[model samples]
Target chain A: MKKLINDKERFLSDMLDGLKQRDPHIEIIEDTVVVRKEKKSSGVALVSGGGSGHEPAHAGYVSQGMLDGAVCGEVFTSPTPDKVLAAIKAVDNGDGVLLIIKNYSGDVMNFEMAQEMAEAEGHHVASVVVRDDVAIDNEEQRRGVAGTVVVHKYAGYLAEQGASLDDIVKKVKEMMSTLYSIGMAIHPCLVPTTGEYGFDLAEDEMEIGIGIHGEKGISREKSASVDKIVNRLLDELFKHTDSSRLIVMVNGMGATPESELSIVTKYVMEALDDRGITVSKLLVGDYMTALDMQGFSLTILDEDDEVLEALDADTGSKYFK
Target chain B: MKKLINDKERFLSDMLDGLKQRDPHIEIIEDTVVVRKEKKSSGVALVSGGGSGHEPAHAGYVSQGMLDGAVCGEVFTSPTPDKVLAAIKAVDNGDGVLLIIKNYSGDVMNFEMAQEMAEAEGHHVASVVVRDDVAIDNEEQRRGVAGTVVVHKYAGYLAEQGASLDDIVKKVKEMMSTLYSIGMAIHPCLVPTTGEYGFDLAEDEMEIGIGIHGEKGISREKSASVDKIVNRLLDELFKHTDSSRLIVMVNGMGATPESELSIVTKYVMEALDDRGITVSKLLVGDYMTALDMQGFSLTILDEDDEVLEALDADTGSKYFK
Candidate 1:
């Protein structure tokens, strides 16, 4: 595996060190959680996290108007409850704290454990699960993908607006209902710890509906043109939402070139325009990424004026913009 | 080779279409150039462009405080003089325009042609060539690589401050003198049009001092750990500058993961700290990229108070932040 790393065991800590060094707005705590250096001190603090590989997701969102703290774990591994509790304690103000947990089995369990621990300590904490990935037919099995970032933005904006933790949870849950995401991969990523490829694929094949951690997708087929692939993902996504106006995110799996992402973005816009769906806001880039996975994901959120205002609100995030 | 493209011939145009659709801040002109939608009406307009593969370079930098226009060519091919002229005319609002060209033979020839054409039409235009790559010992042969984006930010800031085209040119040239960059690649990228790899590498080999176009670098050696590789590149870059305070950018060639880039940023910070050099500012991510190349480049600029202010200035660019 050709990867730029040293001592695979130190990957997470090393990455976090680099992150804190690059941005002054965030500081690392408990050697695993990243929190805003400037505490909110008044409004409800928004906290989110999961595995570490999907970067700029949990930690990258830890900025003034976004996440207050992000509890990071090893690559594709959930953080312990203690680490999550540390993040809660570090960011929670008098207003309370909200946890934006992606709907992964490991993540949900650990974050909930942390919530219970924090509540036992007299901290008021509410948690919301983002199950936006539409690859699976069962809602319970849906895995949150790139759409989780929108949850961060919305929840962060609400918290910044002085919304109660309960109100932020309610609004974020409402937004999550309309969020849908689907991904396809041309090549699978190699997990650094095990030195294993997430999955195997032939040169001319692609996997549709792949998850961020290289989980198996819904189908594997001969690779087609960009439009066909984008349309296929959109078809699955359209079934989950009927909203005419939407916020679209074209997120790259770790290794896809920006040029190719732009091509994917072009076809996505064209496909949406054909369906008469108006894209109220569009973001195209690698926001949440799998480690060295060569693919892209399409995420769409039903748009309302409030959500648009929140997304457009200014933030101190170095990555979100 | 696997790629997410339709007709290789339409790569540039399709990517441009997507870019224009995704961002409202910039508009496409002459079917090849990207210019600001809200053009600056009374200040010197900064314009930059070159080949299409290195994304978020010239085009992504087109925004309120950055380049007023970006002329894009076919992948790895210099844009025609006509497109550059169109960008120059479209953005020049009588206060004159400045061209920021990278140091490539084809690019220098084409942009100069455009400048001559614009000058003949009674428009004031000044141009600066960035030769920051330290891989090549000959000053004239040094390629621009990723440091050109710094030029855009600096020049853009000056233009926003109402600096004359001549003044912008002089200051940018001065800044360019202090800029230095070096890169290393683990694997070469595939060219979409020709369906060929830029270069061949053995399983455990890497190329050092590679250019953005996958051009031959200074050396090829057995792959090593991230820190050693980073130190090797830094050694070459440090030979060109001796400033105690610096601004650093660790840029990814298209396919490197954000996780690896963070690790690189960590080592870079440590190396600078050990040398007693203070990093005034640091940017870590894929800023300028070669299409699907798996590697990174490090760029350091000798920083002064004026340079720091310019780098910190805000812009409407979707990619720069």
Candidate 2:
């Protein structure tokens, strides 16, 4: 696969070790759980995690104003319930713990199992599944993509503010409902274990509405121009939500250059301007990635004043800031 | 080339427009200059620039605690002396201005010309050329690479500290001497104008000691394991200089995934550990990049107390913080 890893099975561990070396504010718990070094005495601890291929997503979010802990699993695989429970136990201050689960079957199941296990031990635990992908017709099947980062920011802000678990979960659920995302993948990513791409497409073709895990996209089409691609993604996103003031994120699906992300963001901004939408806050970077997938995703959040304040809150998470 | 650019000719401008849209603290001047919105009232204005393709290096560093302004030219081409002069005029408050030029023939000549012009226009100006590339045997031919960011951080901190132009330039020159960098490119990047890869390498080949502008490296070798490649690079870097305390950066060359960077960094840390070199501060990510080049560069600075303090200083530059 021409990957820069020592061993395919040890890729996630090596990555986490590297991250811990760079960021002193975080430490590893039970080998798979990454948590803040200075735990809060009492507050709703925010925890989010999934597969490990998404750089700076779940682990990078483990900081002061963002996630308290992130339980990392194998690449494109969910962490076991024991690992998630360990993360919850490590970061739960005294109030409670909230797990921000992305709407993937394995992730939802494992996180829910962990939540139940934690609750059985007399600890307050709540879960919110983020399903912001707009391409899927059925809400139950909609996959959470890069838009989950928005939920993390808002919910983490509330947790840092000493909000109750119920309050943070309720707010995050509302934010998830308002958020919408869809992506186009120019190329599929390689899986380290198999040393093969998850899928393949013709050079002139792209997978529209692709999930972050290299899952089957909604459709395959001839790769169009950047503007046309942006228009298509935005058309679907705008159909799901509309607002004069909004918060937006142009997320990379890994391997995409920052310059290209900026280009995509430029057209997305132009598209929003055409609709007379005022972008209150915008984030342009790889908050969530898909393991070297060459494409970008557009995320729009219909945020209120409180949500905006939370999004702007101070977070030690370098990815968020 | 699968670049997300609108017009090949307008790529740089479009990228700048995208940057301005995301960062409200930065504004463009004279169409080719990016300056901080609020200029330093009376301090040494730090100016640095090269080609346009290095995203976030010269421009993204223009913040309160970083460069006062960045002069941008065409892709992989140096800016005209007039553009550099305009940036100097725009940001020079009352104290003076200092130019941080990477040791490229075009950049050195153009920035020197601009310095002379600015001097003639009654502005105190000085320049320092950073030639930290260690792969080249001849000192005159050594090209500046990712280590220049270390110079920016130190010089920008000094500028923000209200140090005089002479003082900032002196300290930066000393820093430049202690820095050394080496890089490897697995794949060549496409130039926007030509729409062709700058250089070609076989599927099993890699170019070692490559410059940021896709210049020829010291040698081509069979693409070996990541550990073997990192060892070779580190062997050269360590041969140039060794110290008990150092600051290191593992910079991605645009198209390399963040996970791979982390993987590279993992081995880097282990290599340092084996050598018993303690890294005081570590910076990892795409600080300076060639246009979508799939590789990475390692920069090691034998940093003393002052340089370490400056590296840790607060800067409005998002890439740094």
Candidate 3:
């Protein structure tokens, strides 16, 4: 592997160490859970987690006005139920806690187990599963990708506003229902455990409708222009929703450069404008990544003024802020 | 080229379009300049610029408390003297403007000519040329790299505090002298104009003491572990300075992932601790880039509490905030 890492065994722990070193306001618990240094005493604390590779997601979002804690698993793997339960116990204040789960089977099952375990321990816990990827035809099989961060932002905003756990879960589910994300990966991400890529693509070819975990995409084709790829992605996205306005996130799937992301944004925004759809708020960066995958994802969140406000609300997370 | 560009000729303009679309408070002038929508009239306006591909540097820093204007050239090329002159004129309030020039020969010569032209037009202007790289032995010939952003942050904070133009220049020059940086590239960055990488490295090799513009480095070796590579870079950097405290930036040279950047930060912070150097403020992200180079640079500024506070100050720029 061409990755800058020590032992593959220590990748997660070492990464968290690096993350903690950069942000003084974060603390790692038992080396698997990241919590805000000063946990708020009231309201529903937001918690999210998944595999370790998609950085600045669950952990970077752990802060005030965002997630209170993130329970990280190893790369391309789900955290244990014990770790998730520990994360819940760390950040759950008097009101309760909400867990945001991406729709991968492993993550969903593990986070749900933790939720049940936490609830049995007399802590009120609610969960919202994000299945926002429209690439798959079956809703039950759709996998969450970059749009999960938007769910975190909106839920964290509502939770910070002192909404009840039930209300936060309801609002988050509503948002998730309307949100859609689709990715195109030109290269597969490396798996540390195997020291190999999850998949492969030719130097001059591309895959459309890819997922975060390097699952088989909808189709493969010779590398087309970015504008054409964007049009294809957006055409798929626009089919499922009639919302006239959207909150957009043009997220890099790890190794894509900001220059390319900016170019992608230009084309995406221009295409949307040409279609008479207004983008209320747009975020362009590498918020959710697939290790070193060379691709980008477009996440469209159907939004009104309130949803846009929620997404734009102030957050203490270094990445989101 | 594996770039997400519509036309190579329109790359820079399209990028500015995307940037402006994302942030409504920024505006483009003369097709190659970025300026704050509402220039503050009472203080020294900060302006900086160079080549294009370094996204979120000169242009992204153009905001209320950071930079008032950024004059951009085409990819990897310096802006023309007339464009620099236009930028100075655009942001120069009655209080004069400060030009932050990276120490590339083309940039220094062009910006100096612009300064002369602006002064000839009766506009007071002062320029602080940054040459913070420690790799080059000849001080007069060293090129500015990522450390230029630190100069910008510190000087911008001081300018926002209403410091005199002379005082700002003096303090900035002092900081510039104390600042040191060095980078290692795992792969060469592709230049849009040439549609090719500036240099080549084998898959298992790396270049040490590299420049942002793809100038050859001091040495090349088989790709050592990140920790060893970081130690070598810091070894060279420490020989030139004896700063007790540092404000460090672990900057990605374009396509480096945040995960790898975090790993680099872990080793760097550990090394600094081993050397008894205290790091007050450490930022780990892609601030300055060399197109899509898969490498990183370490920038250290000798800073006390005041300088740290200056770096942590609020800015209207979306990237820095």
Candidate 4:
């Protein structure tokens, strides 16, 4: 595989080393967990994490006004329960901790197990699962994708405001109900460890409703124009929410150029405008990604005063801006 | 090529449409120039631009403390002199304007023409050309790459501080002397308009010192590990600057994954540490891109007290952080 890496075994550790070095405010612990250098003395701590490839998601969100810690796993793999527990313990300062778990089977299981272990140690911990990906017909089977970044931002904002763990969990869960995301990929990414493409695609084909881990999407069809592809994705999302105003995120699935994302953004905004919907906030760039997949995802969240306030609030996150 | 675009002819306009939609603070004028919605009233205005594919370079840097305006050209083509003059007229206040031009034959010529036109129109204009790319042996012919962003940030900071146009030009010219940059590409990028790859590269080969416009580099060799590639690039940069402390920017060439960039970052920091050099600032991610090219560039600038203060200054820029 043509990737800028050394031994596959060292990918996670080496990436974390670079993260810590770039931001002095970020501290690495247990070789897999990243937390704030200065712990908040009070307030419910926010912690989130998953596989390593969807960078700037969990780790890049770590800061005072965002996530307090992130538990990282190997590329496209779930972190161990011990690592998650370490992040919870490292950030919790008595007000309790909130774990933001993306709705993937492995991630949900591991994060839940860590929550149990933390509670067994007498720390109050609450968890919220983000199943915002609308690709799957069955809601429970949906895979959380770029919408998870919005979860971190909103929940982290609540935590920074000194909200109780239970309140933060309740609000985040409420917000997830209004969040929906779907992605399409023209090229599949190679799994660094396996040294193989996640899936094969003919030159003229594209995958719709693809997952962030490079999983096969709901369907494969002939490539189409940006407007057609965006209309299809938004058609799926429109079925889930009828909100007149929304907060939109045009996220790139690694390797997609920012120029393309901006082009995608234009179509998305035009599509929404035609439907007489207003976009309250728009974020266009890569937030979550599949190693080197080339595609884009569109996420829409129902606009609310609290949601807008949280997203607009100041944050120390180096990536969110 | 599998790209998310509607019409090749509408590439520049569509991208700018999305940019304006996302940030209401930005205004699109003359069909090609991007200026701040609220222009500065007194301080010298900073205006820069070139080709359209380098997202967030000239346009994304437009804000209160970064750039006052950006004149966008067609994909991989320099902006017309009329567009450059339009940008100058749009952002120029009574304090005059400063143009940051990257050292490309077409760009320098067009921006110089625009400068003369603006001067004849009675607007005081100053221009600085950045020749920071160390890929070419001759300093005069070096192409400005990602290091142009540093020039934007540093000079923008000075402009925001109310520095005189002449002083800003003088300081920026001095700063350019100590800046160095180099890039390498593994896979060639397909220029949308041309419908062809910029250069040819085998699966096992890579190009060193590749230009942002997809121009061929100085050498081609078998792809190596991330550490080795970074060392080779740094070896060239080390010959130019002997500064003990430096500000480093690890820029992805459009399609490189952030995980890979972080891994590259790890090796860069480690190499500098082993060499007894200290990194005072670190900026990573896709700051300057080459339209989905698979590679990255390293930019290093000498660290000075004034440079640090400018780099650390706050800005309304959405991408610089």
Best prediction by lDDT: 4
After superposing candidate 1, which stretches have Cα over 4 Å from the reference?
Answer: none
lDDT of 1 by residue, A96-204 (tens): 9998888999999999999999999999999988888889899988898899898898888998898888888888888888999999999898898888889999999
What 10-residue stretch in candidate 4 chain B is worst by lDDT? B312-321
- Among the numbered candidates, top DockQ falls to 1
User: Candidate 3: which stretches are off by over 4 Å?
Assistant: none
Clashing pairs in 1: none
Model 4: how far residue B281 lies from native, Å: 1.5
Q: Note the chain A TM-score of all models in turn.
A: 0.98, 0.98, 0.98, 0.98
Cα lDDT tens digits, model 2, A30-91, are: 99899999998888998899998888888988988888899999999999999999988888
TM-score of only chain B in every candidate structure: 0.98, 0.98, 0.98, 0.98
For the predicted complex of model 3, DockQ is 0.67
What interface RMSD does candidate 2 have? 1.5
Task: Put the candidates in lDDT order, highest first.
Answer: 4, 1, 3, 2
lDDT of 3 by residue, B242-321 (tens): 88888888999888877778788889988889999988788888888888888899988787666788888988776774
Could you tell me which residue pairs clash in candidate 2? none
